[model samples]
Target chain A: MLIDWFTVVAQAINFLILVWLLKRFLYQPILDAIDAREQRIAQTLAEADAKKAAARLERDEFERKNRELDEQRQSMVSRMQDEVSGLRQKLLDDAQSAAERLQTKWHVNLQRQQQRLGEGISRRVQDEVFSITRKTILDLADDDLEASIINVFIGRLRQLDGEALANFVQALTAAEAAVRIRSAFELTDEQQTAIRQVLREIFPADAAVRFDCEPELIAGIELTAGGRRVAWSIEDYLKTLKDSLGDLVREQDSSQGTPTAESESLA
Target chain B: MQLSPDEQVFWQYGFIKLNATIVYTWGLMLVMALGSRFITRQLSTEHTRSRWQNLLEIIVTGIVKQMKEVGLSEPQRYLGFLGTLFLFIAVASLFTIFPGYQPPTGSLSTTAALALCVLVAVPLFGIQEQGVAGYLGSYIKPTILMLPFNLMSEVSRTLALAIRLFGNMMSGAMIVGILLAITPFVFPVVMTLLGLLTGMVQAYIFSILAAVYIAAATQGHQANPDLATNAPKAHSQTNGISHG
Candidate 1:
């Protein structure tokens, strides 16, 4: 069968016209909307990216600050520890030095106290001895018979050696028999000659002598020859003086818990 | 040539024959359209001279500019429609040089169908862009007294486009056919040449009118009244249509 040219022509024209009309109205508006939507989407994506970047930067800054704070705190603690250590060492040194100084002071004080005590004790002993000697000397009288006897004995002392005679006088002054010699003996020539002969035999010639007589003796004759004195006495005054002094020394020694000659002699 | 008995009977039956020349012409027209599309695509390649690209750029730019003048919100949407219409009409005009090939646009039914599609689509688009009320209001625009006239004008313009394209192409085809039948050879050549020029001009006129009508319907008549009025004049001048 032959194709219809008229129908085909009519159809082609209709198709072209329809295509034109559809393009003018429907396609244009849809395309415009798509373009607007695309632009909006792009803008939203860009804004989101910017916000994310800002957040990351803020977090990084916070971390950095935290790290710095930690470092600072550590440094401060270390510094404090160092200072404390230094202070502790200094205190220790100061305490040690103070202890040493106190020890030295204690030692020096102990030595000085010991020396002072020793000196005071020695001075007290010397004062006691001097007081006793003074009391004994005051008891003697100038016109006493013992004084006359001492004067007669001293008059004959020129025949002795000087050193020996002085020693003899010291011994006579200490003797108990000298006191009896003053009262019991009126010197007869023969007795006096006999004492002189004994004195000459005991001492060197051309010596001066000093004699002391005590009346405390009951009866005695005493002759001082050189540095030595011989006494014959009925009284026990020497034994009594020795006994009292020994008792006093023994009492002192017993109180102090020390050994002495008095206690040894008594034992 | 000896005729067989069955062949003779078949010849005597007076059955309608397919016109070889008409088929050849139609085929040539199709080839021309396809070839033009191929050439345009090839010319778009990187190595082609800038002139071809410049030519296409000028055409696209011109269409965009016209759409802008018409005050369409987005002109790019209409590019595909305009490009298709331009290509179709250009290929349709080439039918003039092919003997016995009739342009499809020459038929009244074809033109009327195309016009009807445009008529229906325009109001639909207008209603979609603006509400139905707004679309109706546009018909009565400028003054209420001009409402009936404007409404009639829209229908008449669509009718005019159908009649114009059909009359112009059919007349050219009839003229060339009559000339070929009477003068067998030499005079027919002159008529064919004249037909080519007429066909191309008529095709261009049809396409431009279609573009103007679309621009008016989509953008609204009030958007650019001056441009709407001037578009048809420019079409006539370019196509050498001396409209009295």
Candidate 2:
């Protein structure tokens, strides 16, 4: 027989045993290893993805912070520029005001110095004119001129009109002191007597008369009774010239749109 | 000249006997068990692995893939029985390159035992898949008049499985032995190489057929629709090779 019953039975049992052995050692372990390796690879990939996401988040945060910082710096720079410009404008205003004050002071000082110079010139000119007029009057003085001056004074007193003649008559009537006369030159006794007779004739009262000589009268004469006086002098005419000259200078200063202290006071 | 290794009995005691088929089968078993145990002892789950581990994994997975192709949806359930059958036959034929060796599959007893295992496994798996009544009812499928044919088919196919493998393996060994006697040279070597090819083909055909039978028993037409088209083709091809 080609087939042995015992061997067939033995081989079948052997085949079964081989199946068990292979299942235990071969299939289970290899399959398990492959599964494990696959799981590990999947986990590693997941971790890598998580790390990449975290890194991206961190990068975004850093960029945002950088943007914020840049914005802050720009704002600060803008604020600084604003402050600097404001300060510069302030300084310019302060300097301009200070310069204006100094210019005003300098201008005022120049005006005061010019005013002093003008006043000195006017005083010097007045003194020279008075000296020359006094010298000419002293040189030209004589008895005949003295008689004409007395007659002119008498004529001027007689020519007093309306309120002037009435005020003079009221003053002579109310006078407690003697009537006084003053002249640039000393009067002669006849001239004095003549002035006393004119005063008596004008007053028509019992009035005392007195006579005086004054150098500052400068070729003019004056009469007084109590506090009342009537006088005419070259100085009066010179005062008119000085007032007109001061007005002219004040008008010139006003036209120029800068009235100096002297011109302001003069106006 | 012995037509089967079973005839080469080493010892006998009444009804019990020892022979080259049993002994060579044990030797193959020992080699497989010990080699599997040694290589699998330090199995690495990492990417890098030993060439032996790689080779074993390829063979095991290849068997799994083949079972799946043959319409066994769950190949792992059948891997042990079907994979053992292939490895035993393939290893037995491969050892033929060694001098003074007779492959165990050349014995009708070993081939009969392997086919008996397949025959038993098919019903066992079918019963596991669909209860005992469901599996038994398949015998009378379509009509009760076909019951005898179905029973006979089961017995006959088991018998065919045994004879097909036995004839191919025994003939290859016999031809190589006879050629060695006549030429004692390169012709037998060439025949031996051709015998190896035949052995590998027989192993594939046997396991694929077993898987098909198991698939048919367990899932019937409910399984892969392509199984219906493929089963007859496999059956015809195997039949052609056996007849040839």
TM-score of chain A of each: 0.43, 0.80
Least accurate stretch of 10 residues (summed lDDT) in model 2 chain B? B220-229
The digit string of per-residue lDDT tens for model 2 on B29-126 reads 89998899899898887778899989988998899898977878898888888898888889999999998899999999999999999889989999
Candidate 1 colliding pairs, count: 6
Off by over 4 Å in 1: A1-267, B1-73, B231-244
Locate the minimum summed-lDDT window of 10 residues in model 1 chain A. A176-185
**In terms of lDDT, which candidate is strongest?**
2
TM-score for the B chain of model 2: 0.96
**Chain B TM (all candidates):** 0.70, 0.96
The global C-alpha lDDT for each of the candidates, from Candidate 1 onward, is: 0.56, 0.84
Clashing pairs in 1: A10-B110, A160-A207, A164-A226, A168-A227, A179-A214, A179-A215
TM-score of the candidate numbered 2?
Answer: 0.81
Give DockQ per model, in order: 0.06, 0.69
